[model samples]
Structures are given as structure tokens and as C-alpha cells.
Target: MRSRLHSPTVRLRRLAAELRRHREANGWSVSETAGRLGWRSPKVSKIENGESRRLSADDLDKLLNLYGVEERGEREALHRLAKEATVQGWWANYRDAFGSRALPDFETEASAIRTYEALVVPGLLQTPEYAEAVFKGAGLTDDAVSIRRLVQARMERQHILFRPPAPHLWAVIDEAALRRVIGGREVMRDQLQHLVNMAGHHNVDLQVLPFSSGSHPALSGDFTLLEFQDPLDQSIVYVDTASDVRFLEKPDEIERYSLIFGRLQGHALSAAESPVYIRDIMAGLESDDRE
Candidate 1:
């Protein structure tokens, strides 16, 4: 589970899932839970969907009991999981300092990540200079030291690429991201090389939507579609904007995003051509005196 390795979000998701299962077992609609528990219909959803503003251990206990799971040991195990799940991970420390949100997931288990980025190099593959330049453009410039630390943190998170039980990552980037000279030519060169190196990894599928491709579904905006291992269960669409992040999980919403991604794949170059594309960009960057 992603929560096991990244954040407490996993446990919260399980809590919601457990509640849902019990409600189904008892043959109760969400309205039934609301009626009996003196909650509004949305409250039932908040708790069962794990979108509650706060995690109440007492509430979880009540739901568990209402579900009629008689085993004390099982209840305790889930309770403990919920408690841990409520705790913050390392990224939480950066909340006030960074204000960057939704870097990880808490619910809707996603076994694979399909990412599309256009303007800048995605955090997973940024060189330090490129990272700083991209952030500076966003007005995140504060202390150079803090900026460097943040960059290091992002690089560390890249370990996920090689971790055990790794998620299959399909990263589709645009040619403009490569052609754009971020942090001057030097940083762009290093960035291109990193892309080449990362593409060699078996777990990663890197493809470039070359500028030659006239238009594609992902052209409107960039979003990631995360697919879980299970069926009709955990899946989400993550869309990041300058000021807010949105997570979409409805079946229709996910289907639309999936279709968009499928169309993008059809227009983009294959993974096998990724390295060649990178090298071509690198050569162009090197010729510039600024590099």
C-alpha cells in the first residue's frame, strides 16, 4: 500500500473501506447509517469515503461496532491502523513552509501512476538548477538554502522508482519541456541525461509527445491517472493547478481521464524512442553558448 511507504493516507482509506464493507454486509444504504447515527447523508459519506475533516477514533470505534464485527482483536487492529493513518508523514512538516499539497495519497489505492507534464520537468526527474528555476518562476524564492533542501527532498523521493513492490510509472512529457532551456543550457543538459538514465530502468516507461504531434487530449492540461490493483475500487485523477490540487475518483471522471491518456499515448512517441529524443535535445542545448 502507498500509505505503508509514503503517508498515513493508506490507513484512513482502509478505515473508510472497512466501514463501507460492513454497511454492505448489513445491507444498509448510506441513508440508513445516517438515520441511525443521527448524521446527515453527507456525514455518512465523509466517514465512509475517508474525506472527513477530522479523524475521530471514537467515531471509528462506533462504526466498527455498528458493523457487528465481533472479534475484539480485529477491531483493535483496525483502530491502531486508523491512529497511525492519522499521523502525518515527513511532507507534513513542509505544509506551512511549502504550502504544496497533495504530494501523496491517503485513500484509493493506486498501483500504477500515469503522469503527464508540459511546462517544466516533473519533480521526479528535476536537476537542482532546473528545480530552482521552475520554483522561482512560481515565486517560491525565499532562502537559497531552503530551496536547495527542498530540491534534495524531491530527489530523495525519487527512490520510489527503485523501491520494492514499485508502482509502474508511465511518465509522458512534452518536447517543449525538454526544448525549453531551464536553468540555462547546463541544467537542461543534465536534465536530459537524467531522463535517459531513468528511461533505462525496467519499471519506468518514459515517452515524449514530440512537438510534431499537432494536438492531443493532454494538451488542454496535465493530470495523472492512478490505477489501483483492485477492480472498481481505488483509482484517482490528480490535477494540480497553481493554487489548488484536485483529486477525482468518480467512475465517469476517471474514465474520461483514462480516455484522454489513451489518446495521448497514441500521439506520443514510443518508450523505445525516448532516449533518442533526449539525446537530440541535449545536442541542441550544447550548441548554445549559454550552456
Candidate 2:
């Protein structure tokens, strides 16, 4: 389980990384920097590690001054980031449904999202009925109210798709996911239709990896790679397992996944053909319904 304390917002993470970079470039150890500021070592460590409960403007200014960051524009930008870090996003209201996970926070900041789904439709593309079915199928909770809340939260997450300057969503879904049939034929049909519809969105690119493609790189599991507009805000890969969720930020990890996704795209049907492919599957489902 992700600890609530350590799940800093994306802005906070960027701020922390910047501060750490400045300290390193100045060739000052954490203890030495803390000593220079007359502050405890842990305080410096926490701020650099993105574990601070809250970062004050005063503290940020002090750190910038020590680093000799005299450029007014740069200082003002960092100050804006510090202020933005403290503002709670709409996701905060849904904490009960999402726990302390920062996936939504990161998603909110992402400028482009590349995702590969092997089991089911990506959450951002799931319909309300399909989402409800998924939550219930996972046995995440027995309470009907909780399931409803989760479904609502999932739907709300999709709002980013429609917002102006929407992040581009490039999704490669496995054929197995399309054929799995969740929430009965009617629901699954609707879900497939939703995918086809979403593919038509200007910012969304959808592809289907048929089973016949066989022996692919991401045969292991699903992962989402989020890229931010700001260069300082590094890209991250999100992996969710039955037991836990992991965020990968290392350059090597990102590169490996990027390669895997590129391969997956190569194996999958192209954007132009994918919706047609889904419609074919939907035709089979309709045939099944009529039978």
C-alpha cells in the first residue's frame, strides 16, 4: 500500500528534484547544506526527497538563495511551483475511493500518455457500466456504495481527455482484453463501442494487438508511461499489480518500457484498422446476443 505521507503531488516532486539538482551542482552534501542553513539534516533530506508535509515559500527562497539562483525569472517560476504544489487537485475529494495512490495526480500533469493494456480496457477509456463491472469483479470491496464511488472516480478521471489541450492518449490493447467479455455481452459490447468512439478523438490513438502477433515484449503485464510538458518533470511509468502499484522513474526503466511499447505498436493493428477490428468483434457479440 502506498503511504499517504509520501505521495506528493507532481508539482512537489518536480520541486524536490530541482532542489536536489541545485544542491548537487553546488557540490554540497545534505549535512553541509543543512549546517549552512542552520537547519537539521533531516529537514534538508525530507525536502529533497519530496517527503515534506508542506514546503513554505520562505524555505524555498532560502534554498534558492543559498544555491545562488539569482535569475529573477527562474526564481519566480520555482516560487509558482511551490505555490501550486500546495493546492489540492480535484482528486483530493475522491481519496476515499482511490486511497493515497498518486496515479491520478501524475495523470493530471501528463502531457502525453502511452499505455498498454493486456487484460482489460484502460481506465481512462472504460465506460461507467464497464468500470462498475470491473470494480465488482475485482472484489475490491463488498459495499455497493464503495463500488459506485470507485466507478464515479474512474469516470471523473476521464475528464482530462476532453479538457482543452488534452494530453494525447496512445493506447495499445491486447486482443485478449477485447474478447474477455466483462459485465456480460451487452456491457462488453458497449465497452467495445466506447473504445471505437474514443479512438476517433483527436487526441486519442488506439490500436489492438491481436493474439496472432504472439510472443511480444510486454507479454508480462500492462504499464502506462506518462510524459510531462516541462522537461524537469521527468516521465514515469505506472505499473499496477494485484498486490501493489509501482511507479518507475529511472531512465533505464523508462527506456526499456518505451522500447517495449514501440514493439507493441509495431505488432498491433494500426490506428486506421483498429476501430474496424473492434467493430468486427462487436459484430460477433451481436451475433451471440441474437443467438
lDDT of 1 by residue, 78-136 (tens): 78767767666665654644354445543223568888999877777777778887766
Top of the candidates by lDDT: 2
In candidate 2, how many Å is residue 252 off? 1.2
Task: For each candidate in turn, give its C-alpha RMSD to the true structure in angstroms.
Answer: 3.3, 3.4
Query: Which digits, one per residue and each the tens of the lDDT, describe model 2 over residues 149-191?
Result: 8999898889889986688999999999999999999999999
Candidate that scores best on TM-score: 2
Which pairs clash in model 2?
none
What is residue 264's positional error in candidate 2, in angstroms? 0.8
